[model samples]
Structures are given as structure tokens and as C-alpha cells.
Target: MKGGNMGNMMKQMQKMQKKMMAAQEELHEMSFESSAGGGMVTVVANGKKEITDVQIKEDVVDPDDVEMLQDLILTATNDVIKQIDDKTNETMGQFTQGMNMPGMF
Candidate 1:
């Protein structure tokens, strides 16, 4: 009886793993956008947590104060990353729901 139960459990686990992999693959095609400095700097990141592109307004460029521009870019990138992280947790949380696996997601 225990052996049969274990086989069933393994099958269930395999199904769950497939679902999780599908979800992750979907995330790879998703994109998140964020802007900083009143939209002067914009960043687009994909679900892979990679920054796809960045756009900087010409008016925001200041050769005398490069630090400010750098700050804006940094802020935009951080925001995009945060967005990806939040979405990943929300999507992947479903699989781990009710499972006491800390840091699994």
C-alpha cells in the first residue's frame, strides 16, 4: 500500500514540476518597464531579470553633472528589477502554496 502511495506522489510531483517549468518559461517572454526622474530615464527588463533596453531624454543629459544621470539610470534599473521580482513571486508562489518550503521560490 505504501509503495503504491509513493508512486502516486511521485507522479503528482512530476506534474507540478512541469507546471512550474512552463510558468518560468512564460516569464522569460514577459517584459516589465520602469522609469525614473519624472520619466527622463526609462528601463525595460524581461522576466529573465535582464535589462532589455534603456532610454534617456536628451534634456536630462548634463555633462557637468553626470552623477545625477547615473543616479536616475540606477533608480530606473532597480525599479524594473523589483517589478520582475514581485511578479515572479506572485506567479511562482502558486506552485509552492501550502508547501512549507522556505526560499523555494
Candidate 2:
């Protein structure tokens, strides 16, 4: 009886691991974009939380308002980071549902 139970538990664990790996792979190929200052600034980031691009509209640049431009960039970058975090959590949560095992992920 003990051996049978152990084998079953192992199989279940393996299956869950496989599902998690698949979900992670899918996330690696995913991406999200965010903008700030009325779309004057745009940021593109991948699911792995890597920034791919930062676009700033020429009209948003002012020689006398460097501080405002800096703030816009910061806002856009932070927005992109938040978006990436949300996507990662939502995607990983799908695989962790109903599983209470700590650190299993």
C-alpha cells in the first residue's frame, strides 16, 4: 500500500511540473506594452521582464522641460514593469491553482 501511494504521488508531482514548465515556456514568448503622458512615451517589455524598446515622441521633448521628460520616461518604464509583473503572476497562478505545496513552483 505504501509503495502504491508513493508511486501515485510521484506521478502527480511530475505531471504538475510538466504543466508548470509548459506555462513558463509560453510566458517566455509573451509580451506587453505600456505608455504614459498621453502616449508620448511607450515601453515594450517581454514576459521575462526585459525591456525591449522605449519610444519618446519628439514633441514631448522640450529643452527647458527636461525634468518633465524625465518624469514621463520614469512613468512609462514603471508602467511597463507593472504590466510585466501582472502578466507573470496571472500566467503562473494558472499552474499553481489548487496546489498548496510551498516552493513547488
- Taking the tens digit of each residue's C-alpha lDDT, what string does model 2 give over 6-104? 999999989988988988888877877888899999988887878899999999999999999899889988988887777777978887788796874
Tell me how candidate 2 scores on lDDT: 0.85
lDDT (Cα, 0-100) at 54 in candidate 2:
90
Instruction: Give candidates' CA RMSD values in order.
Output: 1.2, 2.0
TM-score of each model, in listed order = 0.93, 0.86
TM-score of candidate 2 relative to the true fold: 0.86
lDDT of 1 by residue, 1-105 (tens): 699999999999999999999999999899999999999999999999999999999999999999999999999999999999999999999999898998797
Off by over 4 Å in 2: 98-105
Alpha-carbon local distance difference test for all models: 0.96, 0.85
